[model samples]
Target: MICAPPEKIFRATRNRPALARERARLARAALADCRLCAHDCGVNRLAGETGLCHAGAEARFFSAQVEVSDELELMPTFSVALSGCDLRCDFCITGKESWNARAGLGFDSFQMAERAKLALQNGARTIMVLGGEPTIHLPSALEFVSLLPASAKLIWKTNAHGRTQARELLDGMFDVWLADFKFGNDACAQRLAKVSDYVRVVQENLLWADTHSELIVRHLLMPGHVECCWRPVAAWLAANLPGVKVNLRAGFWPAWHARRHGEFKNSLSVSENQFAFGLATELGLNLIP
Candidate 1:
């Protein structure tokens, strides 16, 4: 028999008290050796120490509440963007304000809480916490979400690297998990994202997601890197995590840091055939493009 869809199962999550308690517990943990995200910097952030992501005890970033309609599966989502990212995807298109952690600003936890409440008041039931990497500033992110009224839904956009430690921050509270499978090869991952162990981290996280929450994996098909980068990862997920939905994106503009980098300077997004043959035919999985 097939496992129920994460959305269907998650809709039944109503243990508000337990979720609240877990959130607080994670908040306290963040003050210690902050293993919030994969970086596991172990710095005493509560003392206002900055980690590699440059996020201190107080979270800093830019945000706007927008109703996401492009993602049909996650349609009508109210999203809050947290600035800063741990990995540097050379082909990133949204690097306008998030490219550099130094560029973002700080907001008090109370003020951030107010912004979340405002989003909810404006009919945003699902709070999509996106960032350079939400896991990097997880404590503040988790605390903010925990303080929200019990009626709000929590969502995240991540690179899926810090599964073992990151799962503790989650504690089965979030309703949705949107992750990116950047490169299939470790060499490519290290060259592109600067993380050599990305494959293992992403795989482990997806395994955890299979048991805990709804996971949607997105892959941007870069022209010269489709088969070598995106294909094997798709194959692995299809075989290991059969039920998770995969979004095969095709439009990868070599903007942002991509243009400056020779590897991506002239790279075109995946074409229709590449999506059909390379990703679709090989994986037999759902295609979002």
Candidate 2:
């Protein structure tokens, strides 16, 4: 659980919609010289120029549905999956849609917000803005936030690879930061997800998120990375963000380009799963089982 009362967040976020609108405006303006993600690709997306993420001037989404397949405390969430990502994780399960920014329907923030409001009315506990990595679609994401119900719990589900400008714009808007810590080091991150300076960027985002909002960290146990990936990740969490809610997920389905790497050719073994869980417990991490 998040260890926070819903009413406390509700009381504090009365001005969230207004603040999101202002941030949305700023985000759109930044598209002229984009620095949203850690890549710092200064492509002028406003002029049909593309960057590492390949996303253009508008936001697109492949899915928007209410689902309970999330952290227990934040279940029954209305998930809005934006279509593009900055990193190129070859084993991405949603690669067909996520790797290509132009793969989905163009977003209409007001319409999507209305749908999310209806979801809230129908018992959805949170409105989750996820991606491919929402930072790439900052303007639209913030615009969606600006239109959501002020009392609705909002979750920013991310890969934790955003830059300082994004963190500032997202500062006080989200109720929860459901982020992923995929790799423990830069070498593995570069080999697996094609991202550099990974550990520093993710840790910075996590530390800031922990201080700013209700944060939950999740690491999907890979078949051959128990020692090199999860071990260091768990150790860091136990040492730096002790007591933070962590979810050590064991399911690892090899999808998309997973076949390209030997380690990604199969599912996580029972031994790997057991070791990962045991290590998390031994590290005294507050795992949300």
Evaluated with lDDT, which candidate comes out highest?
Answer: 2
Clashes of each: 2, 0
The whole-model lDDT of each prediction reads 0.69, 0.91
Can you give the TM-score per candidate against the true fold? 0.85, 0.96
Task: Give, for candidate 2, the lowest lDDT window spanning 10 residues.
Answer: 4-13
Candidate 1 lDDT score at position 230: 71
The per-prediction CA RMSD against the true structure, in angstroms, equals 3.2, 2.8
lDDT (Cα, tens digit) per residue for candidate 2, span 105-195: 9999999999999999999998999988899999999999999878888999999999999999998888899999999889999998899
lDDT of 1 at 287: 62
State the displacement of the C-alpha of residue 285, model 1, in Å, after optimal TM-score superposition. 0.4
